[model samples]
Target: MDIKAVQSSYARWAPVYDKTFGAITNVGRRCAVEYINSRGGSVLEVGVGTGLSLEQYKPDMHVTGIDFSAEMLQKARDKVQALELSQVEELRKMDARTLDFPDNHFDTIAAMHVLSVVPEPEKVMAEIARVCKPGGKVVITNHFERKQGVIASLERLFAPFANTIGWHSDFEIETVLQEDALTLEEQRALPPLGMMTFLVLGKSGG
Candidate 1:
């Protein structure tokens, strides 16, 4: 997929993406934030679309968000401003594959619905792990192609159209994450939503 094209597409869809995908995403965000809080840490959220998850974050936790779309960042900026959280939240236009923070920088890094859309999942995960303190947590939630059954067939069938619109790779996230030594702490599917996976992973030998 073309990075520029994907960015442009998201920029165009920024206004409606949240409303269209909010139902499931709202649950995903809550889940991600809860997991992060459970681990207790300074947090970073990648691909924070319209800042829907901002409210889910506890006020005591400091957070930084990064996304590639300016328009989407604009919406998120507006949201942070509206909520009077400008001092606590920082949203930047950035690529997940190449995070700007220093090594072992954050205690928790959340990537909600971000990996599947990126061209380099492994690189992004590596960057995520690099900035996380040892034993720190990495939370990821993304739409995936079910291993089997009717849903998988539908995903395969419409993949062409979906690919053109915004969707990217739908490969097994478990296999991908494991390859980079990010141990899966927990994995569960969100009920009634078979296409997505909510996962909590920890750094190896942390």
Candidate 2:
């Protein structure tokens, strides 16, 4: 998807996101956050739309979130204020392709159910690798296209509507795995018929 498509699609979905796509992706979010909480430290949460996972982060873990949508970020900000979540250090509007943070900044980075929605995911992944501290982990949860199955057929059917739907149904896992500095450490399928996947990639040094 292009930036305009992403922006417009999310602007439309932002109002009902928590009950719609957000609910469908809840398991992935929970699994990712639980794992991050276990490895508590400085975290950079990419695509932290509406801050749905913000409250679940352990209080001891320092968290910073970034998103491209102002509408979504506002909701996230409101949630942070209402809940008084002290762990959240900041939430900024940013493009994942060009993250504003310095190199080796965060201990962990989370990209939950968002790679397919953003433009230039490879560039985003490169930026993710660049900023993550060596030995830190990049956690991801996303729906990847199946090779052959009823799901694969369904994915093809919806592939054309990615811009309108706000996420690519045929998104490939390889798009996020090409960064040399990050090595795949774990991979697993998530619930709801294993449509979604959980991945952990460790940065190459400490």
lDDT of 1 at 69: 84
- Output the lDDT of residue 171, model 1: 61
TM-score of each: 0.92, 0.99
Worst 10 residues of 1 by lDDT: 167-176
Q: What tens-digit string does per-residue lDDT give for candidate 1 at 57-120?
A: 7778888999998898899888888888733458888988889999988888899887877767
**lDDT leader:** 2
CA displacement after TM-score superposition, residue 157 of candidate 2 (Å):
1.0
Q: At residue 184, what lDDT does model 1 achieve?
A: 85
Each model's lDDT comes to 0.78, 0.96
Give the Å shift of residue 130 in candidate 2.
Answer: 0.4
1-206 per-residue lDDT for model 2 (tens digits): 98999999999999999999999999999999999999989999999999999999999989999999999999999999999999999999999999999999999999999999999999999999999998899999999999998999999999999889889999999999889999999999999999999999999877
Give model 2's TM-score versus the native structure.
Answer: 0.99
Give model 2's clash tally.
Answer: 0
